[model samples]
Target chain A: MSSITWQTVQAEALRRIRTREWPPGSRIPDEAVLAAELGCARATVNRALRELAEAGLLERRRKAGTRVPLNPVRKATFEVPIIRQDIEGRGLVPGYRLLTRAVEPAPAALLASLPAGSLPPGAQLLRLRALHLAGDAPFCLEERWVNPLTAPGILVADLDGISANEWLVQNTSFTGGDIAFGATNADAETAAALDCPPGASLFVIDRMTRAGEALITSVRLSYAPGYQMQAVI
Target chain B: MSSITWQTVQAEALRRIRTREWPPGSRIPDEAVLAAELGCARATVNRALRELAEAGLLERRRKAGTRVPLNPVRKATFEVPIIRQDIEGRGLVPGYRLLTRAVEPAPAALLASLPAGSLPPGAQLLRLRALHLAGDAPFCLEERWVNPLTAPGILVADLDGISANEWLVQNTSFTGGDIAFGATNADAETAAALDCPPGASLFVIDRMTRAGEALITSVRLSYAPGYQMQAVI
Candidate 1:
């Protein structure tokens, strides 16, 4: 037996499998039993089984018991983020230009999503809208809102140079948030910016953040389908 | 001296913004000054600014200081999960299904993604193509795999009435994983399964999971662009 204990159990599991001793779909011995057979602790066996389940090798449930998989694959999840970093990471220049910026009354949905009674009566929410471009192609359309009462200074920034992403990274911080993601048939406004027709599919993100005790920001982001976010850990 | 505390700081900030007291692109007070003014701690002010930055409201850097957004609204991130539960929390059936199952050799990319030399040579891998139907329509098409060496008993499962999601949940436990999400142009085969044309964009999730000491599962999940997972926190 090799000095390393866990690898040995993994090897034995494979050995038993290749010899067809356990057979397919038959529940393997429990952790306690496997430990006795392997001359190791139940923890080692548990670790091996846990890893296998994550890799789609085995399946287990509460009170249901564990077993080998017939077709042992599991679902994959990917992360999505801003476009400039996306382009630059591929060794390309990140560029941006504001499409529009205005201060308008927050929408009803925006209002509802916020904590009740965040704004004083007749508060005109500061709205900022812009399009992010990558290599002359429109990559995203960003529409965002700020509670002026929460953030007193929002009206004067150099919009021609930096993106909100870069600005935020360089200027402020994000502590915690609740975020949502979806795929949608693009609406007319997004279609116009993305150069795709309305009803085209788009990836959408909506989020709200609280700065400790302060409600800091609320935003809606839209991306042309095919933009992807990848994070390796 | 208000009941809201941080929310008060945030609400007042919004009011000041609406009146242009801070203006667009103007720097705001630091944590020390703001907390003193707001009668809070430096940590609390930091929290508010950090949140505002994420919401695309403020800009601060190591030396630059915090300021109002030219375009203060930022992209909000939402976790992607299931819709029925999201809708049904207001009460609805969180329904699901199984579409198809097959066994095929692991693809070259998939093999590379899997733990090298884990399986004995020339083992015909198990591939299951299952559709997750929510209510009556196709919600997701899950194509998964299984390594017989990991769990030998999977071969006996008659998945006609059962789902891979439910079956796997009933069978295995995993510690954690690496997840990725992005938009991809669909290939011919995947498009047909999702009912979209080849070259149309599909949201893709590519992830790998670890059991205990081994890489057990790797999968690519493709969804029609209109599918969005929403969450609240």
Candidate 2:
């Protein structure tokens, strides 16, 4: 209402806090003192402190005053991951090595998850077993199930230098899916493949990616337990 | 997949894992072997193993095999919180006593972020200083700002009976927010309110809540440093 400036005053308060001119744990100068120093009304200081407190940078209390906070816990947020992008982001050359690929009769249940139609001529299932390694050691062993009705070309898709993670994130926008996270022990195969001993712990993530009304892919990823999903929160 | 005969296979696998019949780190019979034993086809056994792996009970490898997991680190997840619910969820009676509430001139920036008028006419900035206690001592001191435009009748809102958190969750869906988590030393007021001596460590969550286009509410939550948030990731 006074046509008085706000940003300058807010900026001044922030500067004082950042510089520790008002050291944390110590109360900021009282309203009258801050008002005099800032050449503004107490309402202006109130606005500034209120905003900082909202930002988890300061704390306000009655009978005492406003002070700086020490640790901010929930401030950390989750970093959602898209694997291939994550690999490249980590400065790695992302490549997919097809260790085994085959087309066989569809498992009955898998076929049932599909539309209720008679199996096409030689309506075989395509099984692609691949190893995703950061450099030399295997990073993940992917056992993915793809529906031919939805992604027919995937049976012969060129995947030598690309990852399903990137390819999917690029070519399609799968609407939804369920994600499950847990821990398990690596069997002998996973142990040898991932270079860990049998019974070693591994972080497991099983996700079923979906489109509007279609199931796109069901993937199972096993990670060495040393893997960490750290978030600031 | 096969006449629901697969459910029995899944049940048997689950029972074996839990009973340690398939002892942790021990290899499980492969599809062909397991199918014969379970009186089902290899496909059914594969399905059972697939679900078990998905559930984190086993890790199936191509040539290796499936084995039980020992330590399920168990995923932990944390959702941003409303302090009171956070406290109560921890088995504490979330108590809030408003120390002060009134309509005051909106600070300039807040004024800009609020409705199209000067503190609106009857509008007043409601400042409520509340004490949140655990069992006997103060757990958190919440100093919140509520805009009358959005939080109409704020002056008469009954917060003593219900926590600000449960109410907000039921009453509104927030658009977005920014949170900063950090530690802070308690001041004289915070010290007295939280029953801690000055300079004691405290966890602080400073955050802003937005509704659609306007800044709905801003809150500062100060807690004892021992406070921890645990979630099933």
Candidate 3:
């Protein structure tokens, strides 16, 4: 045998759990005991166990030690890629067409979600509507709002060369954001853009980004029918 | 002023990113330099930076050092919550009705997804269909397949008191799994169960769980209209 690395420790522990040797909700040996049994340092065992704990397979407490999770709600991590990259990754040509550009008052829902003092009352926000394409077919429709105070240059920025989604990712500085996924029945305007029938179910991704305490942008992307997102846990 | 802790270090770093002090695609100071500047240990700075990197705000390479991510596609982490907990958390009484249960030949898709040698040829699998409820209204419909070889006791187990979802989590030990989210037009049977019109869009979650080399279960959960999932990044 070579040596007991953290990877090997993790694999062995996983195998034991899978075989019911350490059944669900049952406490496992302490880190020191595991380290001694595996002939490894306690730190190595601790690292391995910590990873499993973070993955929702094991639960740990200060004095109670670790136990296999009874109701393990596994988490799936997804990288929310930009529209162009997502399309290009599938061996398709990515393109976009800018449809509408105007200044408008922020909607009530948008105003409610924004942080207090982030935007002045009755401030005009730059609104843009565009269609993303995968070569000849429509991929998604983008509706976005840019807060003028957060992105002062957006009003005069070149909107033809690159999409607002791409531009925002490249130029905007945000510390955090929120995203939501849902299904919506396509209205006439969206149906016309995606070439689908009215009332067809479309996958929608809504996002809001913040730069520190200030809201940067809020966007909604409505994808064509049959869009699916997958992840491994 | 507060002493330099990991939280402070993280906050300072986020402030720099948000203010454009450390612009996108710009290399950040190394751990030793940042530690000296902040009057903290290198490990504290390392921990703070690692958290940012994991959150997709920074990218680190061995020789290249850390830099603000050029295209920060912020990740949204979602816990795959149990249906009962989800309903109960919403202050609704959680209930379920077992619609169908039978042993049948594995479907082609199920057989295809299962690992070779995990099951014998022409094996009978336990298939289940059930309706989960929030109060008296139908919440979602679940269709599941349990590999008999991996879960031998499932054939005769009392599935009425506990849902197959709950039972699997308690009894099965999975090493890894995959999950997918999409929207599907409900078929006649699914529409009947959910009390919706046929061809109405339904949010779907498909999952496959594996225990070491053995396949455990494959499940599809189709939710009623207006179901939405949100996450913060």
Q: Which candidate leads the pack in DockQ? A: 3
Q: What is residue B173's positional error in candidate 2, in angstroms?
A: 23
DockQ, computed on Cα atoms, for candidate 3: 0.68
Top candidate, metric lDDT: 3
Query: So what's the TM-score on candidate 2?
Result: 0.36
Models ranked on TM-score = 3, 1, 2
Q: How would you class the docking of model 3?
A: medium
- For each candidate in the order shown, give its overall lDDT on alpha carbons: 0.63, 0.62, 0.87
Name the docking class for model 1.
incorrect
Clashes in predicted model 2: 15
Q: Kindly list the per-residue Cα lDDT of model 2 for residues A123-222, writing each as its tens digit.
A: 6656666777766656777776665555656766776667665555444434445554444556788778778777665556666666556666667777
Candidate 1 lDDT tens digits, B1-233: 44546566776666665456877789877779988887788766675667556555667787788888665444433333333333345344444445556667767767666566655556666677766545555555677776655545567876766655445444544444566666656668777776776666566677665555444456677776565555443
lDDT per residue (tens digit) for residues B116-174 in model 2? 53234554566667777777768778877776666545456687766554455444444
Could you tell me which 10 consecutive residues in candidate 2 chain B have the lowest summed lDDT? Answer: B69-78
Candidate 3 wrong stretches, greater than 4 Å: A112-119, B1-3, B112-120
The single-chain TM-score for chain B of candidate 2 is 0.58
Displacement of residue A42 (Cα, Å) in model 2 is 21
The sequence of per-residue lDDT tens digits that candidate 3 reaches over residues A1-233 is 55789999999998888787998889999999999999999988997998888878899999999998778877778878888889988899999999999999988888987779767888789999999999999999999999878876888999976998778777777667788888877889999999998888888888988877777899999999988887778
Can you write out model 1's per-residue Cα lDDT over A1-233, one digit (the tens) per residue?
A: 43547777876776665454655578877888888876788878876777667545578786677777554444333333455766666666666777777777777877777776656556677677778777777777888776666554555667667765555434444445676666566678888988877766566777676555445667777786666555432
